[model samples]
Target chain A: AQSVTQLDSHVSVSEGTPVLLRCNYSSSYSPSLFWYVQHPNKGLQLLLKYTSAATLVKGINGFEAEFKKSETSFHLTKPSAHMSDAAEYFCVVSDLTGGANNLFFGTGTRLTVIP
Target chain B: GAGVSQSPSNKVTEKGKDVELRCDPISGHTALYWYRQRLGQGLEFLIYFQGNSAPDKSGLPSDRFSAERTGESVSTLTIQRTQQEDSAVYLCASRPGGGDNQPQHFGDGTRLSIL
Candidate 1:
Protein backbone atom coordinates (compact mmCIF):
# COMPACT_ATOMS: atom_id res chain seq x y z
CA ALA A 1 0.00 0.00 0.00
CA GLN A 2 1.09 3.57 -0.70
CA SER A 3 0.02 6.71 1.11
CA VAL A 4 1.15 10.30 1.73
CA THR A 5 0.80 12.40 4.84
CA GLN A 6 0.99 16.16 4.74
CA LEU A 7 2.29 17.48 8.03
CA ASP A 8 0.43 20.73 7.99
CA SER A 9 -3.24 21.31 7.32
CA HIS A 10 -2.64 25.05 7.10
CA VAL A 11 0.46 27.20 6.93
CA SER A 12 0.80 30.97 7.07
CA VAL A 13 3.84 32.91 5.97
CA SER A 14 4.58 36.61 5.65
CA GLU A 15 5.56 38.07 2.35
CA GLY A 16 9.33 37.97 1.64
CA THR A 17 9.71 35.13 4.16
CA PRO A 18 10.59 31.57 3.38
CA VAL A 19 7.89 28.87 3.17
CA LEU A 20 7.90 25.18 3.83
CA LEU A 21 5.22 22.47 3.59
CA ARG A 22 6.15 19.05 4.88
CA CYS A 23 5.07 15.66 3.54
CA ASN A 24 5.90 12.05 4.35
CA TYR A 25 5.19 8.90 2.40
CA SER A 26 4.88 5.18 2.92
CA SER A 27 5.19 2.92 -0.08
CA SER A 28 6.23 -0.64 -0.69
CA TYR A 29 7.95 0.11 -3.94
CA SER A 30 10.11 2.99 -5.13
CA PRO A 31 7.49 5.69 -5.62
CA SER A 32 7.07 8.62 -7.93
CA LEU A 33 6.27 11.77 -5.99
CA PHE A 34 4.63 15.01 -7.11
CA TRP A 35 3.55 18.35 -5.77
CA TYR A 36 0.45 20.00 -7.23
CA VAL A 37 -0.99 23.42 -6.52
CA GLN A 38 -4.64 24.33 -6.89
CA HIS A 39 -5.70 27.91 -6.82
CA PRO A 40 -9.25 28.78 -5.84
CA ASN A 41 -11.75 27.55 -8.42
CA LYS A 42 -8.92 26.39 -10.62
CA GLY A 43 -7.49 23.12 -11.77
CA LEU A 44 -4.50 21.44 -10.18
CA GLN A 45 -1.18 22.43 -11.70
CA LEU A 46 1.81 20.19 -11.34
CA LEU A 47 4.57 21.95 -9.48
CA LEU A 48 7.20 19.28 -9.89
CA LYS A 49 7.71 15.54 -9.99
CA TYR A 50 10.41 13.16 -8.70
CA THR A 51 10.60 9.93 -10.65
CA SER A 52 13.70 8.31 -9.22
CA ALA A 53 15.56 11.13 -10.86
CA ALA A 54 17.00 14.19 -9.14
CA THR A 55 16.42 14.37 -5.42
CA LEU A 56 16.07 18.13 -5.57
CA VAL A 57 13.30 19.02 -8.01
CA LYS A 58 12.54 22.59 -9.01
CA GLY A 59 9.08 23.59 -10.15
CA ILE A 60 7.11 26.44 -11.59
CA ASN A 61 6.72 29.74 -9.83
CA GLY A 62 9.49 29.66 -7.19
CA PHE A 63 8.53 26.38 -5.55
CA GLU A 64 10.68 23.30 -5.17
CA ALA A 65 10.77 20.01 -3.27
CA GLU A 66 13.44 17.60 -2.18
CA PHE A 67 12.96 13.85 -2.12
CA LYS A 68 14.65 12.24 0.88
CA LYS A 69 14.61 8.49 0.87
CA SER A 70 16.20 7.96 4.27
CA GLU A 71 13.79 10.37 5.92
CA THR A 72 10.80 9.15 3.91
CA SER A 73 10.01 12.77 3.23
CA PHE A 74 9.37 15.16 0.35
CA HIS A 75 8.90 18.70 1.58
CA LEU A 76 7.95 21.66 -0.62
CA THR A 77 9.72 24.95 -0.17
CA LYS A 78 10.13 28.46 -1.56
CA PRO A 79 12.59 31.23 -0.82
CA SER A 80 9.99 33.97 -0.54
CA ALA A 81 6.26 33.94 -0.05
CA HIS A 82 4.08 35.70 -2.56
CA MET A 83 0.40 36.58 -2.40
CA SER A 84 -0.26 34.56 -5.51
CA ASP A 85 1.14 31.49 -3.77
CA ALA A 86 -1.89 31.19 -1.53
CA ALA A 87 -3.56 27.96 -2.52
CA GLU A 88 -4.01 24.30 -1.65
CA TYR A 89 -0.98 22.10 -2.04
CA PHE A 90 -1.19 18.36 -2.47
CA CYS A 91 1.59 15.82 -2.15
CA VAL A 92 0.95 12.79 -4.28
CA VAL A 93 2.53 9.39 -4.66
CA SER A 94 2.12 7.08 -7.61
CA ASP A 95 1.66 3.38 -6.91
CA LEU A 96 2.60 1.16 -9.80
CA THR A 97 2.97 -2.13 -7.97
CA GLY A 98 -0.44 -3.23 -9.20
CA GLY A 99 0.39 -1.86 -12.61
CA ALA A 100 -2.60 0.47 -12.29
CA ASN A 101 -0.53 3.61 -11.77
CA ASN A 102 -3.13 5.26 -9.52
CA LEU A 103 -2.10 8.22 -7.39
CA PHE A 104 -2.41 8.47 -3.63
CA PHE A 105 -2.75 12.05 -2.43
CA GLY A 106 -2.17 13.71 0.90
CA THR A 107 -4.89 15.46 2.88
CA GLY A 108 -3.42 18.70 1.47
CA THR A 109 -1.80 21.75 3.03
CA ARG A 110 -3.57 25.09 2.69
CA LEU A 111 -0.99 27.84 2.29
CA THR A 112 -1.84 31.39 3.28
CA VAL A 113 0.52 34.10 2.14
CA ILE A 114 0.25 37.06 4.44
CA PRO A 115 0.99 40.59 3.33
CA GLY B 1 -2.47 23.11 -26.29
CA ALA B 2 -5.55 22.47 -24.20
CA GLY B 3 -5.35 20.58 -20.93
CA VAL B 4 -7.99 18.19 -19.72
CA SER B 5 -11.46 19.68 -19.94
CA GLN B 6 -14.45 18.89 -17.70
CA SER B 7 -18.07 19.75 -18.36
CA PRO B 8 -20.76 21.24 -16.15
CA SER B 9 -18.40 23.46 -14.17
CA ASN B 10 -21.04 23.57 -11.50
CA LYS B 11 -24.02 21.30 -10.86
CA VAL B 12 -26.68 21.70 -8.21
CA THR B 13 -29.27 18.96 -7.97
CA GLU B 14 -31.72 17.37 -5.61
CA LYS B 15 -30.73 14.19 -3.87
CA GLY B 16 -31.50 10.96 -5.71
CA LYS B 17 -31.10 12.57 -9.10
CA ASP B 18 -28.73 11.08 -11.59
CA VAL B 19 -25.92 13.26 -12.94
CA GLU B 20 -23.37 12.76 -15.65
CA LEU B 21 -19.95 14.44 -15.77
CA ARG B 22 -17.84 14.63 -18.86
CA CYS B 23 -14.10 14.85 -19.50
CA ASP B 24 -12.11 15.63 -22.61
CA PRO B 25 -8.46 14.72 -22.26
CA ILE B 26 -5.51 16.16 -24.09
CA SER B 27 -5.09 14.96 -27.63
CA GLY B 28 -3.07 11.76 -28.04
CA HIS B 29 -3.20 10.94 -24.33
CA THR B 30 -3.86 7.28 -23.66
CA ALA B 31 -4.69 7.36 -19.96
CA LEU B 32 -7.62 9.06 -18.22
CA TYR B 33 -8.57 9.19 -14.54
CA TRP B 34 -11.44 10.29 -12.31
CA TYR B 35 -11.07 11.62 -8.78
CA ARG B 36 -13.20 13.26 -6.12
CA GLN B 37 -12.22 16.00 -3.71
CA ARG B 38 -14.47 16.63 -0.77
CA LEU B 39 -14.43 19.86 1.17
CA GLY B 40 -11.16 20.29 3.09
CA GLN B 41 -10.00 16.90 1.91
CA GLY B 42 -7.51 15.55 -0.58
CA LEU B 43 -8.31 13.92 -3.89
CA GLU B 44 -9.70 10.39 -3.85
CA PHE B 45 -9.01 8.28 -6.87
CA LEU B 46 -12.24 7.01 -8.41
CA ILE B 47 -11.36 5.22 -11.62
CA TYR B 48 -8.75 4.83 -14.33
CA PHE B 49 -8.82 3.93 -18.03
CA GLN B 50 -5.97 3.01 -20.28
CA GLY B 51 -6.08 2.42 -23.99
CA ASN B 52 -9.08 0.06 -24.41
CA SER B 53 -7.89 -2.11 -21.56
CA ALA B 54 -10.30 -2.99 -18.78
CA PRO B 55 -10.46 0.01 -16.47
CA ASP B 56 -9.11 -0.15 -12.95
CA LYS B 57 -12.22 0.45 -10.90
CA SER B 58 -10.92 -0.49 -7.48
CA GLY B 59 -10.90 3.08 -6.24
CA LEU B 60 -14.59 3.70 -6.95
CA PRO B 61 -16.38 4.32 -3.66
CA SER B 62 -19.66 2.65 -4.58
CA ASP B 63 -21.49 0.77 -7.30
CA ARG B 64 -23.53 3.88 -8.13
CA PHE B 65 -20.41 5.49 -9.51
CA SER B 66 -19.34 4.36 -12.97
CA ALA B 67 -17.23 5.71 -15.81
CA GLU B 68 -16.54 5.03 -19.45
CA ARG B 69 -13.94 6.21 -21.92
CA THR B 70 -14.15 6.25 -25.69
CA GLY B 71 -10.86 5.11 -27.09
CA GLU B 72 -8.36 7.78 -26.00
CA SER B 73 -10.71 10.71 -26.23
CA VAL B 74 -13.70 11.70 -24.16
CA SER B 75 -14.81 10.04 -20.93
CA THR B 76 -17.95 10.28 -18.86
CA LEU B 77 -18.64 9.53 -15.22
CA THR B 78 -22.19 8.83 -14.21
CA ILE B 79 -23.61 8.73 -10.72
CA GLN B 80 -26.96 7.00 -10.20
CA ARG B 81 -29.33 8.06 -7.42
CA THR B 82 -26.76 10.45 -6.09
CA GLN B 83 -26.69 11.04 -2.38
CA GLN B 84 -25.63 14.00 -0.30
CA GLU B 85 -22.32 12.35 0.34
CA ASP B 86 -21.74 12.46 -3.39
CA SER B 87 -21.50 16.22 -3.29
CA ALA B 88 -17.92 17.19 -4.05
CA VAL B 89 -15.65 18.40 -6.78
CA TYR B 90 -15.28 15.72 -9.40
CA LEU B 91 -11.92 16.07 -11.12
CA CYS B 92 -10.80 14.50 -14.36
CA ALA B 93 -7.19 13.91 -15.29
CA SER B 94 -5.20 12.40 -18.12
CA ARG B 95 -1.64 11.42 -18.88
CA PRO B 96 0.18 10.39 -21.98
CA GLY B 97 0.56 6.80 -20.84
CA GLY B 98 0.54 4.47 -17.83
CA GLY B 99 4.13 5.28 -16.96
CA ASP B 100 4.65 6.33 -13.37
CA ASN B 101 6.84 9.21 -14.48
CA GLN B 102 4.01 10.92 -16.38
CA PRO B 103 2.28 13.54 -14.27
CA GLN B 104 -1.50 13.67 -14.60
CA HIS B 105 -3.01 16.82 -16.04
CA PHE B 106 -6.21 17.91 -14.33
CA GLY B 107 -9.30 19.88 -15.32
CA ASP B 108 -10.97 22.61 -13.34
CA GLY B 109 -13.49 20.00 -12.19
CA THR B 110 -17.25 19.90 -11.82
CA ARG B 111 -18.46 21.17 -8.47
CA LEU B 112 -21.44 18.96 -7.64
CA SER B 113 -23.69 20.24 -4.92
CA ILE B 114 -26.45 17.87 -3.86
CA LEU B 115 -29.40 19.62 -2.40
Candidate 2:
Protein backbone atom coordinates (compact mmCIF):
# COMPACT_ATOMS: atom_id res chain seq x y z
CA ALA A 1 0.00 0.00 0.00
CA GLN A 2 1.09 3.61 -0.57
CA SER A 3 -0.03 7.01 0.58
CA VAL A 4 0.88 10.67 -0.04
CA THR A 5 0.78 13.72 2.16
CA GLN A 6 1.10 17.32 1.05
CA LEU A 7 2.38 19.50 3.89
CA ASP A 8 0.35 22.55 3.15
CA SER A 9 -3.11 23.37 1.94
CA HIS A 10 -2.22 26.82 0.66
CA VAL A 11 1.00 28.53 -0.35
CA SER A 12 1.28 32.19 -1.24
CA VAL A 13 4.21 33.56 -3.18
CA SER A 14 5.25 36.73 -4.97
CA GLU A 15 5.96 36.71 -8.67
CA GLY A 16 9.70 36.26 -9.36
CA THR A 17 10.26 34.74 -5.92
CA PRO A 18 11.08 31.18 -5.22
CA VAL A 19 8.32 28.60 -4.71
CA LEU A 20 8.23 25.43 -2.72
CA LEU A 21 5.64 22.71 -2.12
CA ARG A 22 6.46 19.93 0.29
CA CYS A 23 5.34 16.31 0.14
CA ASN A 24 5.91 13.05 2.02
CA TYR A 25 5.16 9.51 0.97
CA SER A 26 5.04 5.94 2.25
CA SER A 27 5.10 2.73 0.24
CA SER A 28 5.69 -0.89 1.10
CA TYR A 29 7.69 -1.43 -2.05
CA SER A 30 9.52 0.76 -4.54
CA PRO A 31 7.32 3.74 -5.34
CA SER A 32 6.58 6.16 -8.15
CA LEU A 33 6.10 9.81 -7.28
CA PHE A 34 4.48 12.56 -9.30
CA TRP A 35 3.27 16.12 -9.24
CA TYR A 36 0.27 17.53 -11.09
CA VAL A 37 -1.21 20.96 -11.48
CA GLN A 38 -4.75 22.11 -12.06
CA HIS A 39 -6.10 25.45 -13.08
CA PRO A 40 -9.53 26.74 -12.24
CA ASN A 41 -12.21 24.46 -13.70
CA LYS A 42 -9.66 22.45 -15.67
CA GLY A 43 -8.32 18.94 -15.71
CA LEU A 44 -5.02 18.07 -14.10
CA GLN A 45 -1.73 18.42 -15.98
CA LEU A 46 1.26 16.30 -15.17
CA LEU A 47 4.12 18.29 -13.76
CA LEU A 48 6.86 15.72 -13.12
CA LYS A 49 7.46 12.18 -12.00
CA TYR A 50 10.19 10.29 -10.17
CA THR A 51 10.45 6.56 -10.77
CA SER A 52 13.79 5.72 -9.15
CA ALA A 53 15.55 7.02 -12.23
CA ALA A 54 16.78 10.39 -10.97
CA THR A 55 16.59 12.26 -7.72
CA LEU A 56 16.02 15.53 -9.53
CA VAL A 57 13.13 15.59 -11.99
CA LYS A 58 12.46 18.70 -14.00
CA GLY A 59 9.06 19.31 -15.49
CA ILE A 60 7.24 21.76 -17.70
CA ASN A 61 6.53 25.35 -16.55
CA GLY A 62 9.96 25.60 -14.93
CA PHE A 63 8.99 23.33 -12.05
CA GLU A 64 11.24 20.66 -10.58
CA ALA A 65 11.16 18.17 -7.70
CA GLU A 66 13.81 16.22 -5.84
CA PHE A 67 13.22 12.82 -4.34
CA LYS A 68 15.05 12.16 -1.08
CA LYS A 69 14.79 8.62 0.14
CA SER A 70 16.29 9.32 3.52
CA GLU A 71 13.68 11.95 4.32
CA THR A 72 10.87 10.26 2.47
CA SER A 73 10.19 13.53 0.75
CA PHE A 74 9.71 14.78 -2.80
CA HIS A 75 9.44 18.52 -2.66
CA LEU A 76 8.65 20.70 -5.66
CA THR A 77 10.56 23.90 -6.27
CA LYS A 78 10.82 26.70 -8.79
CA PRO A 79 13.63 29.23 -8.75
CA SER A 80 11.30 31.94 -9.93
CA ALA A 81 7.55 32.08 -9.83
CA HIS A 82 5.32 33.44 -12.56
CA MET A 83 1.84 34.79 -12.39
CA SER A 84 0.70 31.96 -14.60
CA ASP A 85 2.03 29.53 -12.02
CA ALA A 86 -0.87 30.26 -9.74
CA ALA A 87 -2.74 27.00 -9.51
CA GLU A 88 -3.36 23.98 -7.34
CA TYR A 89 -0.54 21.45 -6.96
CA PHE A 90 -0.84 17.83 -5.91
CA CYS A 91 1.68 15.29 -4.63
CA VAL A 92 1.04 11.74 -5.67
CA VAL A 93 2.54 8.33 -4.95
CA SER A 94 2.02 4.81 -6.26
CA ASP A 95 3.33 1.37 -5.49
CA LEU A 96 5.21 -0.22 -8.35
CA THR A 97 4.16 -3.63 -7.12
CA GLY A 98 0.53 -2.72 -6.62
CA GLY A 99 -1.97 -4.54 -8.78
CA ALA A 100 -3.24 -1.38 -10.41
CA ASN A 101 -1.19 1.61 -11.49
CA ASN A 102 -3.62 4.02 -9.92
CA LEU A 103 -1.94 6.90 -8.09
CA PHE A 104 -2.62 8.01 -4.54
CA PHE A 105 -3.00 11.78 -4.45
CA GLY A 106 -2.54 14.27 -1.65
CA THR A 107 -5.17 16.76 -0.63
CA GLY A 108 -3.39 19.42 -2.74
CA THR A 109 -1.77 22.79 -2.09
CA ARG A 110 -3.20 25.87 -3.70
CA LEU A 111 -0.55 28.25 -5.03
CA THR A 112 -1.46 31.90 -5.06
CA VAL A 113 1.04 34.14 -6.83
CA ILE A 114 0.93 37.81 -5.93
CA PRO A 115 2.33 40.00 -8.64
CA GLY B 1 -9.16 17.27 -31.08
CA ALA B 2 -5.63 16.24 -30.33
CA GLY B 3 -6.46 15.54 -26.71
CA VAL B 4 -8.98 13.57 -24.69
CA SER B 5 -12.48 14.95 -24.94
CA GLN B 6 -15.44 14.73 -22.54
CA SER B 7 -19.03 15.43 -23.42
CA PRO B 8 -21.70 17.44 -21.60
CA SER B 9 -19.09 19.79 -20.22
CA ASN B 10 -21.53 20.88 -17.53
CA LYS B 11 -24.47 19.11 -15.94
CA VAL B 12 -26.88 19.95 -13.16
CA THR B 13 -29.07 17.24 -11.74
CA GLU B 14 -31.35 16.88 -8.77
CA LYS B 15 -30.31 14.67 -5.91
CA GLY B 16 -31.24 10.99 -6.34
CA LYS B 17 -31.30 11.34 -10.11
CA ASP B 18 -29.01 9.30 -12.34
CA VAL B 19 -26.32 10.94 -14.44
CA GLU B 20 -24.04 9.62 -17.12
CA LEU B 21 -20.77 11.30 -18.07
CA ARG B 22 -18.87 10.36 -21.19
CA CYS B 23 -15.21 10.23 -22.07
CA ASP B 24 -13.57 9.94 -25.48
CA PRO B 25 -9.93 9.06 -25.11
CA ILE B 26 -7.20 9.96 -27.53
CA SER B 27 -7.17 7.85 -30.67
CA GLY B 28 -4.99 4.74 -30.32
CA HIS B 29 -4.43 5.09 -26.61
CA THR B 30 -4.87 1.82 -24.79
CA ALA B 31 -5.13 2.97 -21.18
CA LEU B 32 -7.96 5.14 -19.92
CA TYR B 33 -8.66 6.54 -16.44
CA TRP B 34 -11.36 8.39 -14.55
CA TYR B 35 -10.85 10.73 -11.60
CA ARG B 36 -12.89 13.02 -9.41
CA GLN B 37 -12.01 16.43 -8.01
CA ARG B 38 -14.13 18.06 -5.41
CA LEU B 39 -14.01 21.80 -4.96
CA GLY B 40 -10.74 22.78 -3.24
CA GLN B 41 -9.48 19.21 -3.29
CA GLY B 42 -7.02 17.13 -5.26
CA LEU B 43 -7.75 14.58 -7.94
CA GLU B 44 -9.11 11.28 -6.66
CA PHE B 45 -8.58 8.16 -8.71
CA LEU B 46 -11.85 6.47 -9.60
CA ILE B 47 -11.03 3.68 -12.02
CA TYR B 48 -8.64 2.58 -14.76
CA PHE B 49 -8.89 0.30 -17.79
CA GLN B 50 -6.02 -1.23 -19.71
CA GLY B 51 -6.68 -3.20 -22.85
CA ASN B 52 -8.97 -6.14 -22.05
CA SER B 53 -7.82 -6.49 -18.47
CA ALA B 54 -10.43 -6.21 -15.76
CA PRO B 55 -10.71 -2.64 -14.60
CA ASP B 56 -9.39 -1.49 -11.26
CA LYS B 57 -12.20 0.00 -9.26
CA SER B 58 -10.67 0.08 -5.80
CA GLY B 59 -10.55 3.83 -5.82
CA LEU B 60 -14.19 4.31 -6.58
CA PRO B 61 -15.88 6.07 -3.68
CA SER B 62 -18.99 3.95 -3.65
CA ASP B 63 -20.96 1.21 -5.36
CA ARG B 64 -23.28 3.86 -6.68
CA PHE B 65 -20.66 4.69 -9.26
CA SER B 66 -19.93 2.44 -12.24
CA ALA B 67 -18.07 2.74 -15.52
CA GLU B 68 -17.70 0.86 -18.80
CA ARG B 69 -15.34 0.98 -21.78
CA THR B 70 -16.24 -0.34 -25.19
CA GLY B 71 -13.57 -1.67 -27.56
CA GLU B 72 -10.84 0.68 -26.30
CA SER B 73 -12.77 3.74 -27.25
CA VAL B 74 -15.50 5.63 -25.43
CA SER B 75 -16.23 5.26 -21.69
CA THR B 76 -19.24 6.22 -19.68
CA LEU B 77 -19.49 6.70 -15.92
CA THR B 78 -22.88 6.16 -14.34
CA ILE B 79 -23.78 7.51 -10.94
CA GLN B 80 -27.04 6.21 -9.58
CA ARG B 81 -28.89 7.83 -6.72
CA THR B 82 -26.60 10.78 -7.00
CA GLN B 83 -25.97 12.68 -3.84
CA GLN B 84 -24.85 16.23 -3.28
CA GLU B 85 -21.39 14.91 -2.53
CA ASP B 86 -21.20 13.46 -6.00
CA SER B 87 -21.20 16.96 -7.37
CA ALA B 88 -17.72 17.64 -8.65
CA VAL B 89 -15.63 17.75 -11.75
CA TYR B 90 -15.19 14.33 -13.30
CA LEU B 91 -12.00 14.09 -15.33
CA CYS B 92 -10.96 11.55 -17.94
CA ALA B 93 -7.43 10.73 -19.04
CA SER B 94 -5.73 8.43 -21.53
CA ARG B 95 -2.22 7.28 -22.22
CA PRO B 96 -0.66 5.79 -25.30
CA GLY B 97 0.24 2.10 -25.10
CA GLY B 98 0.68 1.16 -21.44
CA GLY B 99 2.93 1.61 -18.42
CA ASP B 100 3.85 4.88 -16.74
CA ASN B 101 6.56 6.23 -19.03
CA GLN B 102 4.21 8.06 -21.35
CA PRO B 103 2.34 10.72 -19.42
CA GLN B 104 -1.44 10.70 -19.60
CA HIS B 105 -3.39 13.24 -21.60
CA PHE B 106 -6.47 14.72 -19.94
CA GLY B 107 -9.79 16.10 -21.03
CA ASP B 108 -11.13 19.43 -19.83
CA GLY B 109 -13.59 17.50 -17.56
CA THR B 110 -17.31 17.43 -16.88
CA ARG B 111 -18.67 19.64 -14.16
CA LEU B 112 -21.45 17.75 -12.38
CA SER B 113 -23.69 19.69 -10.10
CA ILE B 114 -26.36 18.17 -7.89
CA LEU B 115 -29.06 20.52 -6.82
TM-score of each: 0.96, 0.92
Q: lDDT per residue, candidate 2, A1-115, as tens digits?
A: 6788899999999999999999999878778788989899888789999988989999998999999999999999999999999999988776656566656779999999998
lDDT against the true structure, each candidate: 0.93, 0.89
What stretches of model 2 exceed 4 Å from their correct place? none
Estimate, for each residue in B1-115, the C-alpha lDDT of model 2 and write its tens digit: 6789998999999999999999999999998999998887777889999989899998899999999999799999999999999999999999885554466788999999999
Please give the C-alpha DockQ score of model 1.
0.75
Which stretches in model 1 have alpha-carbon errors above 4 Å? Answer: none
Predicted model 2 interface RMSD = 2.1
Task: Please name the candidate that would achieve the greatest TM-score relative to the true structure.
Answer: 1
Number of the top-ranking candidate, with DockQ as the measure:
1
As for candidate 1, its clashing pairs are none
